[model samples]
Target: MKIHINQLEEGCILAKDILSASNKVLAYKKTIVTEHIKHALKAFLVNEVHVENLLEDGRGFLPSGIQKEASNEEKEKVELTPVKTFHQLYNHAVMERKQLFTGWQSGTQIEIAKVRQIILPLISELKHQEGEILKLYQYCKKEDYLSHHSVSVALLSAFLAKRLGYDQGEINQIAITGLLCDCGMARISPVILTKKVTLTEREYLDLKQHPVHSYNLLKSIMSLKEGVKMGVLQHHERMDGSGYPLGVKGDQAHPYSKIVALADTYQAMVSERPYRSKQSPFKVLEQIMQHDFGRFELNAVNELKKAVIKFSAGTKVKLSNGLKAEIVFVDEQFPTRPIVKIEKTGDITSLKDKKELYIQEIF
Candidate 1:
């Protein structure tokens, strides 16, 4: 019944309580071992735990990680599959998320295994390639906005976590936190979800309770890390107590929650909506620093800044005035506005001096 944390897979039932080093109960016995349990066990430094021989569905158990050796054909088949581009992966994840959200709306229980299969490979590819993923907002359409939003937030959050120096395990959990932060919205009316017009005050209020709904959905999965569950619940909460559901502020919000909140806000601002046009992430980041100060964690904000401002000499870009240019120099102090040589006249312009212009895209 006892097994290591990395060996955890969905449907494994806990046979004993999960306790901290201080012997404080973290999760009670009879809980399901699934979802973010690996991260939680690593976070707690719990080496192993007792589990039921049969899975939660009463099926016989064989540890998934303890699989038989793969045949050469199986390995060849995996290698033969064409690698997906970042956009391709993003689109696939969005479709998968849409189906999952629909199921959640219909009151189906979440299967953590499916969630992992949907996201983990996509996450791995992005992290490995550092691909042109930030501009995924450009691909968004009104009809698929919800699913697109979830996938974007997950990618951005994972990038920010890496920039913030989290270990791989913690970063993975944060990515899931981003992906599921809005899962509670499934419980909201479909009319509200797909509405073209502004929500009524009452409808808006109902929409705001999504964090609580998301928390409720995730809270019952005992093997999931508490921080991840709390992260989903508090994604809308602000550090300054201006956010909704619980209005929790400062350290009262989980760090993962803060990361999700930051990614969610950034992605929402950049992705076009039915009501508002998208803005440049540079503009949004500047606004967050100058105006939305105290509402977000500064480290998360800085990591996002670093991620977005990364540019080098000779990188091609588009300016706000619609001219294509090539980066000539990037001042670390003035990262958002890099100096470039305009393709039209070969005129070198220091973006810092052109207050009205900013780099729109790096092609």
Candidate 2:
């Protein structure tokens, strides 16, 4: 039975793992509770937990002494708005983007004003409630690739921009860059874009020209900021000089471009595509820090790391071994391998030392 943490008594067995806001396991299922465990739960900010056998004894309700009456004003202040509305708003934004991209493909001129209209409301909402926005993204399970990717990049870029200390106006510009960075993809043939098979060399080269296409399209927007235009143009450019269009390296690429590039890469990695399943965001972050270190800007990468940790810290995860666990801790030095508590056993394992274990998914 589910019970408030304050109502928990010593010797009660947990019926399910209690996860923190970030989805980390605060207490494992089946663990025999003790005073020490109760303290730990409080420290982790847990308010409720499920106890096995409690309901069977007809003791599911909170004890009278433990139940505190709340004033109507206080209850109203704490009431939660429905998250469904946010999801609907997100979906509407995506559909608007889809229409915008479709119009661009049909020879409609790209308008900065229209693009801003399509994204600004969503961006404002995200800025106000980032955690809720992230949770919606993580669990919504929608599959419209172009629109979903665009929105994801926009949100991630805005977040990174904020972390880098950009002013509000500049941050909004960065978001616009992310939203329109892949506008060139609309010019590509849908067959190639959604192909389940690998592209031939010529096809690959043709696909790589989207950034240039995006740049040429956006160049027509007279009121658009040069930095925003350049960000879209150079987002595919790499720090190690291995990126497409022009292989500018190091300081050659615009800072805003680097920010979009990192966000774009991360969003794409975690998103599902026709040819591959989506990867866990944590695993992708680890890969970026390890194998792709020099290919992305260090500052941008570091800021993104912090954002990912904040958004994913307490998320429930499944390991490669098929065991269900909750992430209890995220190690700064070894992010890919966070400490997780096994739900069934209450045993904590550090992914850093468990070379054979890795996170497979987040839920």
Candidate 3:
């Protein structure tokens, strides 16, 4: 089937490929269309179709293109870095929660210790890997998502804080704030937590209340500082006053809140959710950049962006042409395309230098 990449200003259309929410179809006609589709599919997959207007594209159109394949060697060069240990940790968190909820006679201290052992060292290295942190965290699946999300955000936050030139204490605090950001969710009902359907308005309201829940939970932990508590409470608040729990805007929000917001949004976008599969980290960064100036602090956003690029070194990715390759290194200035090693004929392609090549997504 013929495919077009422009329809509603930024989504894509498929000719022969089947269109379904469950499938990993990433093309969109307009950027908005793609975002809309993502939101809709998540809602659809979870049966959260109450927002009827959501699926309606303001400028609906179809775009199509031909499918292409990369050389066999190219495919071999692109591999998902194993997140095996992290995956197990995330799974353990879920299992721990389940056993706790089910009233099973406790028995997972070793697992918790294992997770801590892995996480502590990873957190230590997090500050150096801005871009690659998301890639490393993508190994999570649905069951372990929330657990993975908390850990991923902590890692990213630590890295981002260091990049912004925060001292070690400040960096560690950022990581701690991120690690405990969602601790309040442990108090929420499992019925809402494990639901496969889209959240109802009431459910969303409850979910929004989680920041407060988180704040309260942290209050019991005496080791947390005022800034850390504030970060837990206000991380969801937006600069535009559009976020929830408390509608504080701009400078009213704490510095930690701003940092947490960036880390949270970035982590969520790259991690799979009940409603939608994760998008490419590059795409997530692009979206973040699009909103950076107005919705987020400028320096923080730029620093986080730099961290992500640096972390993506030696990662394999799929290009727009369906070719697979490994990223040798990324240019700080030009992030979308970096120096890549294409498996096909061992050609070295640079996004800056390659005239016809474009990165479709980073796997």
Candidate 4:
């Protein structure tokens, strides 16, 4: 049977090959109709729908407005690269983590170097498509905390480094730094890592010391450079000198460290933490932008804003009204209220320009 993509979950079957028809999709699969899939499908269909609100049964659907229809030639030009499934990304992260962390000793420089080497290429792969990282963040599941967030942060850090115009060598080093930045957590007691209850003051202090713990573990690795070691040490440092292991401030903090700090916070906020649910990516980005510039470099924040906007537009999202819509454009300066087109009617509405609705999250 045919189905809308929003209706399909993790294991649903594709009914048929998705093909372009005259004005509408003809041989599309059940997998092709999802709200998320539809946005990507637009690169193929070139047809964008506008979101709308109707007073009928409270069911959200698109309200028709100005219709910018897709052309056959445009459809032919669009190559819908089969989006790699998030589960596949998740599984890869999980396998890699297990392989690297198992039988590990504290200060196993050889093992750490090997892990860094293996992960650098993957980070580079993701950096080239930073937009994909944003998309993957939207699709991430909550349960697999370790693998998913680790890869996401690495990809994010790599993307940030690239945006800053770091050469390939620097990007690889930073990416490797990000991937292994949290390796110290592996040394902490699992109970503390996944603790359900609030920690005692002593436990809190211990947790905050992870960065130093991380640095100590990495200092012996002859293969790692000063930048890489500094990355692990300063990833948590805030611009205001509130960060741990050393409240190193301003230019004293390495640029790669700054990028990792921003990436780590953004990924952590968007990914599910043990104590809290994941915040929406848009919300997380906005929050970071709003914070005092000293906490994160202004230039880094600006670059991050670009990465968020690139992959975020045309993605399926949940709005404050609980209606589903596709992001149409981003207000680069505003960062939070993006222009969205409601799914049913294909109207281009701006959340910032129009005051009626606000975005809740990427679904």
Better of 1 and 4 by lDDT: 1
Q: Write the per-residue lDDT of candidate 1 for residues 1-363, one digit (tens) a residue.
A: 777776766656678877753355655675555444535565554668777866555443546654434334322222123434677777888999999999999999877777776777777777655745567688788788899999889888888888888998998899888898999998999899888889999999999999999989999997678988999998999999999788889999899999999999999988888767777666677678779998999999887767666634677878889999998887767767778999989999998899999877666
TM-scores for all predictions: 0.75, 0.75, 0.62, 0.70
Off by over 4 Å in 2: 1-84, 132-143
Best by TM-score: 1
Over 179-207, each residue of candidate 2 has an lDDT whose tens digit, in order, gives: 99999988888788878778989889889
Sum up the clashes in candidate 3. 21
In model 1, where do residues sit more than 4 Å from their true spots?
Answer: 1-79, 312-315
Q: Candidate 2, 114: how far from true, in Å?
A: 1.8
Between candidates 3 and 4, the lDDT winner? 4
Location of the lowest summed lDDT over 10 successive residues in candidate 1? 74-83
Number of clashes recorded per candidate: 0, 5, 21, 14
| Candidate 4 structure quality by residue, lDDT tens digits, 212-246 | 87787789878789898898889998888988778
What TM-score does prediction 4 earn?
A: 0.70
Give all candidate RMSDs, comma-separated: 11.9, 14.0, 22.9, 15.7
lDDT (Cα, tens digit) per residue for candidate 3, span 231-349: 98989988888887889989999888889898898888877776777777776776677655578767888886776676678877888688998889888777766899986867888
Q: Give the per-residue Cα lDDT of candidate 4 at 65.
A: 52
Q: Rank the candidates by TM-score, best first.
A: 1, 2, 4, 3
Whole-model Cα lDDT of every candidate shown, in order: 0.79, 0.79, 0.63, 0.67
Least accurate stretch of 10 residues (summed lDDT) in model 4? 46-55
How many Å off is the CA of 120 in candidate 1? 1.1
